[model samples]
Target chain A: MAELVFLKLGGSLITDKRRQETARREVITRSAQEIAAALAATPGLRLLVGHGSGSFGHFAAHRYHVRQGNLEDWRGYAETAAAAQRLNRLVTDALLAAGVPAISVQPSASAEAHDGVLQTMAVTPIRTLLDRGVVPLIYGDVALDDVRGCTIISTEQIMALLVAALRPRRIIMAGEVEGVYTADPQRTPTAERIPAIGPHNYAQVEALLTTAFGVDVTGGMLDKVRTLYGLVTQHRGLSARIISGRPPGAIERALRDPSAPLGTLISGDGAAASPAVGGR
Target chain B: MAELVFLKLGGSLITDKRRQETARREVITRSAQEIAAALAATPGLRLLVGHGSGSFGHFAAHRYHVRQGNLEDWRGYAETAAAAQRLNRLVTDALLAAGVPAISVQPSASAEAHDGVLQTMAVTPIRTLLDRGVVPLIYGDVALDDVRGCTIISTEQIMALLVAALRPRRIIMAGEVEGVYTADPQRTPTAERIPAIGPHNYAQVEALLTTAFGVDVTGGMLDKVRTLYGLVTQHRGLSARIISGRPPGAIERALRDPSAPLGTLISGDGAAASPAVGGR
Candidate 1:
């Protein structure tokens, strides 16, 4: 009914991509509870959530060598995407069991692959589901590959694509850490957590981050942010955030404020400009 | 291991295609029991089983208008194929419960749609399963099609392709009827069951027969015979039958018999052979 908040649930926090443990159960359970609470806390705001495949997918994709190099194996990509679909179903089932009316619209079932890039994207079908108030969930996928074959379309790409197409007001990416840290907290003792990032310093922030360089095996964080930056700058579209998903109600606060406590924010103005401050 | 015998279990007899009801439970259950009994009775043979999507699939593909023509709407095909995949899982579960060690290898997961007409048949991944004495079960699939858009590679095509490539010893197609009949016995007062049909005359017989009718949705008796004929005519391959799959022990007899009863046997030599008369 109401406009939606495109919530991207990062794989790192939910599934522990590093250890290949589907550890997001407690977090997801709490998040779902928080989401329902958020719906109650706020008024008349619809939500469409997309979750990454966590370790079940990322670790498997890497172990199976889906993204071994720049060159890709189309079939392997498709298979890796299939693995993600399987995880999507698993997640959908979990959500449904918790009374979240979720559906999985796999990317492979939608996008027509043209070599390595998407040639045509059919979003009309998905829009109908979203319009009907059903939370349509999507994830990173092994997409139709024309050349080296199946390309891994990250959830970040999906988010960017959806934003570019829908021009939503804002996007929220839920991760394990509190926003984008100037450094990896686990490794560096004083890796300062950057409160906010703008289009102006996107390249700088990206330099600090060489891909999603944490637990993600599907690729690195760099691809995710790069994809988001590409979407925002190229399309001059909506704002997005990379928030820490581990917090009890981080997504809810992020949805309410331009500044959420968790993860970094990447606004359309390139990571530069007058950044939206976190209210926390 | 003994040469492989590829078995195709048609869906028409076991359930109502549209509603996906296990209407043929009496027959299939008995068929399963008998098949197990026969396997215990008979020795020195290995089998690779492929079950059709049955009513579960044909209804979706046709009802959804997927088969009307080829289009770029792979999404539609994806829906249809997903329907078939559901049925495949259900049937695989059923067979496993029936004591047949079958593993469902979804066609969409394994098949590649090239410039149409199945360029290369790859059972490469499932070879180890087959080698381990596990029945590698494949089914009709709405595979990711390359040309005619989303293509329906039917169970018939799967059999044809595998037989052509694997060059199996014999192929048995088990369905509802008591072999090929002169006409629809239910509709015709004097419909006679044809015990056997000569290779070249099978089509001619089908044109003149009355009992070749009925809920013969899968192109009736003639279509089955024609496919069976085409498949076995090579390797000077083993004989094939179109039998009443409902009768208890019929499939087993058909599978284990030096000669099996209950169906018309199509031989490469154009002889009107009986599975019971001369086991191929």
Candidate 2:
């Protein structure tokens, strides 16, 4: 039986900001179906899914200049939030279409986190959905902050909040790039693809992080890894992985077999890690 | 017959921010009653009202560093908007309670013009409210802007928008003080309340205009007169008056009779004038 797994779908993996997008509804749907199939085979696995705002959030933020809170740009914040909402609805609807009895927990309604980390996540009603064999689909949203005002609540941040609250044992971050890389594949020609990494790989992890992912207004990949590592290690017993979201079936394949080297795994010091080959 | 009016309610007239308040709800309630009564007496006079965010908007915007666009403060904009929303609902309820049949046209739903004026005002519904003797109420909101980002669309701006769009014959701006004065009442020994002046009364208005008045994040008499005069005289058929919002039942008197010496009136010639006194 596999443990409870948190699946994080990165916006970059699912969207192209260069083009206006209708959330990859079909893809998310198919993925949910596949997950449901896989879960039937593994009775003990608890699955929680979260997707990003994709092309919707980033482009709208840039279009409206929401980053610069001028007196005139206040409504830009509202419009930007509305865009995130449209994308969120698409994703939630897709899950339900796949027969994943999903519920939309609008982050804005319960977004009063102590410093944005979910001091009180009203996710109990969400647990009922999972019990009814329903998938509670979570996504990146326009979250209300007590500090920095309105901002993109990144999928990674969503996962951290869920992990701290849900106590998921295994985490998988899926994206198109086949897993976390040592550097940008397009920019860094020789940037190595990290097959697997853990707590002991601190130097290796820090070296792989780049400040070049286009100044994320809501933080970026580096932010995700840094945040994940902190949360998982603190839990003492939680095991997590960073996996490629691509090949369409990669997530299911990695989850089904422990040996599949899909991404970096962050977890406990005492946990047995893959003795697999360090990829080039 | 008095012309339909667009009124901007200043912050000081509503909330006391220094003490961190939801404001005395009765002041807002009574003011709604007064506006309703005035409108009822003069069937020709209709009002589109906008109120300031007061205690909620100021402290939150600054305390959360919302303008800085920090990651943590993402929801601050919404939080503050909700705060103003509470006041708006209260005001609307008050008017309804008084049998005025008022409706709140939240800024998010209304079309605006650069926070300076309004164009394409879909005031049919508001007009409907007026047809039925209902007042259309608005508030200083976290307005959605196409440019100049996240500014508090001052109630003055909303009133300016309302006046320009509706081409109201006269604007009655109500504030906490007795009326627009010749000098700041708090600072000057002879800051005699200017009973009247020419339309372009900035010189006198400036004298009376203090830097700020408590929870009034918007500037003093200068800004008030400047925006009102700018909007009213944009064409040939409009005029405006600046008067005290306090001392219950005063605005009603001014609305009921043009001869009422309620506030300083600005006419089309860009010279200061009193509502009925004419320039001395």
Per-candidate clashes, comma-separated: 40, 33
What TM-score, computed on C-alpha atoms, does each candidate reach? 0.56, 0.48
For model 1, the docking class works out as incorrect
lDDT of 2 by residue, B93-158 (tens): 566666664546555333433433333334444444444444567677653333322335666666
Q: Which digits, one per residue and each the tens of the lDDT, describe model 1 over residues B225-259?
A: 77677666665746676777776667787777646
- Candidate achieving the largest DockQ: 1
Tens digits of per-residue lDDT, candidate 1, A217-255, equal 323556667776666666554666777778677766876
Error in Å for residue A205 of model 1? 15
Question: How large is the i-RMS for each model, in angstroms?
Answer: 9.9, 15.9
Question: Residue B176: error of model 2 in Å?
Answer: 43
Deviation from native of the Cα of residue B187 in model 1, angstroms: 1.3
> In lDDT terms, which candidate is top?
1
Q: What is the lDDT of residue B148 in candidate 2?
A: 26
